[model samples]
Target: MTSHVFRVGNGHDSHRLADGGPLVLGGISVPHNRHSVGHSDADVLLHAITDAILGAAAEGDIGEWFPDTAEVNRGRCSSEMLLEVWTTIQQHGYSIVNLDCTVFAQRPKLGSHKLKIRQHIAELLKIEITQIGLKAKTGEHVGPIGHEEAIAAHCAVLLQRTDSLV
Candidate 1:
């Protein structure tokens, strides 16, 4: 068995909001008047989750793997990026134990969409929906998040080593 049986990682991401519709979060499109601005599709939730997985595996960050400077990364789908990361970690013999995620947004309440988000993430990770925990919070009109100028997300993941190696 591996020297370490478990590992934990945390990740965060944020993006400025621009006037638009169909805000994408966790691979699901939500009805909103604003969308996140970034080189990719800018799904903050997925980005954070992808980072958490990479961190847990002691792998490089998402930016290192998918640099914004590359034209191929422009408008790339966040879900596809995440899947690639997931596949890499699995190849390294890491399996997810559980994941907890939080999203901060001032507009468009996310209570109704939480289930779908969890389900989608579970599908991507090939884990049970029960293994994922998700929460939504508002900035209460205080800062960039509260002012609806940006959206942010955080994710924490527990991973287990599945291979026999040091």
Candidate 2:
């Protein structure tokens, strides 16, 4: 069987630190004292992944689709945003083949928590956990992230066209 596959998109997202703000990461509310600074929930990882998918499919960027000023998105769940992205991809007759993403932060050792993040993303996209790749990195005390006052993420995605249902 021949399937069409030849597209790429990169997504990058970052957020400032909010002291005593709710720390929500990868759709999971992490136990951290500092939260992300943004109008929405400020999920750096999900934001990056969403952009990657939308970019790969040539749909559009996250901001255009989900404006921060929109009342529908005020303090909304990032997972819901991601699900909407999935819908957009499906609408374009695209399917996520695989995705690789990395999260950058200074505090909170991520080695042990990578699996949880991976599982949650897999469930959200309704794909196998193995298809989702999650990596965590520390800024090594070098930049704003190193100072533990910010977080960022990078996502690369591959999308392929499946047979049209119609």
* Stretches of model 2 off by over 4 angstroms after superposition: 1-4, 164-166
> Against the hidden reference, what TM-scores do the models get?
0.96, 0.92
Summarize candidate 1's per-residue lDDT along 1-166 as a digit string, tens digits.
Answer: 2579899999999999999888999999999999999999999999999999988888989999999999999999999999999998898888888999999999889999999999998988899999999999999999999999999999999998877334
Worst 10 residues of 2 by lDDT: 1-10
Please report, in order, the local distance difference test score of every candidate based on alpha carbons: 0.93, 0.86
User: What does the lDDT come to for candidate 2?
Assistant: 0.86
Clashing pairs in 2: none
Best by TM-score: 1
